[model samples]
Target: MKTPPDRSGITFEVGAQLEARDRHKNWYTATIEKIDYDKERVLIHYRQWSRRHNEWFQWSSPYLRPLERVSLRRQGLNAPMFVSGSKVMACWTDCRFYPAKILRVNKDDSYTVRFFDGVVRTVKSTKLKPVDEVRT
Candidate 1:
């Protein structure tokens, strides 16, 4: 079977939660406020920051990304046992939430996450939170 055609000029939806970058390039949790399909841009409000800081970026811009998790590649119609190119916040060594990407998934059901700043460590699943799923 063939995959359905994607919606033209649309990548994300309004009110969808996401991880976004601030002007200083810091990664933070945010939610979609609005979208301009004609321009392919999205307006986002930072979760912890004030509404005054809301900003817009092209919908497909790297600044906007799915919340992260321990992503698996191609389990292919097997058990619903694998998972995304998603973005999520994992507690760093300092216990602060930071934007992290999956470097590896350990057989122990833990993940080896590497922050954008070059810090890497093996972390249990409990310490990770999906970007959109996190309430704050």
Candidate 2:
């Protein structure tokens, strides 16, 4: 793993590993997508993969989700920031984002995002960034 450059507060482009919480609040792997960053926050684009349908879908109506914590797979590598709105390429199967909107910005630096499909989700700031600024 390599260190991610320090681009906090600057809208940068990047790919993200998105996870969604089930009813139990346990995180489950979801789709990865592109993002756009603005200051401390970001706008995320959602990409959804349906196993049952065996296909991929692009969504932009859904708001961005912030990342809480990013960890590197190896030691001493700068972990990736889960910025909002930044675009991410698929590293594996079943990674994508869902179109959503920001309903509210929480005091804990988290956001309440609502999808066009009527799903309201809460995401942290760690998952967003500008679409053009990502390295890959």
Best by lDDT: 1
Deviation (Å) of 26 in candidate 1:
0.9
Write down the RMSD of candidate 1 (Cα, Å).
Answer: 14.3
- The candidate 1 region of ten consecutive residues with least summed lDDT is 73-82
Q: Report the lDDT tens digits of candidate 1 across residue range 1-136.
A: 2321253422366776767888899888788898776676779999878999999887667676665321221222222221323456888878888888777766666677777788887776668887666476
Number of clashing residue pairs, candidate 2: 48
- The count of residue-pair clashes in candidate 1 stands at 5
**Clashes per prediction?**
5, 48
lDDT per model, in order?
0.68, 0.39
- Estimate the TM-score of every prediction: 0.45, 0.27
Candidate 1 collision pairs: 66-87, 67-87, 68-86, 68-87, 68-88
Candidate 2 achieves a global lDDT of 0.39
Off by over 4 Å in 2: 1-95, 129-136
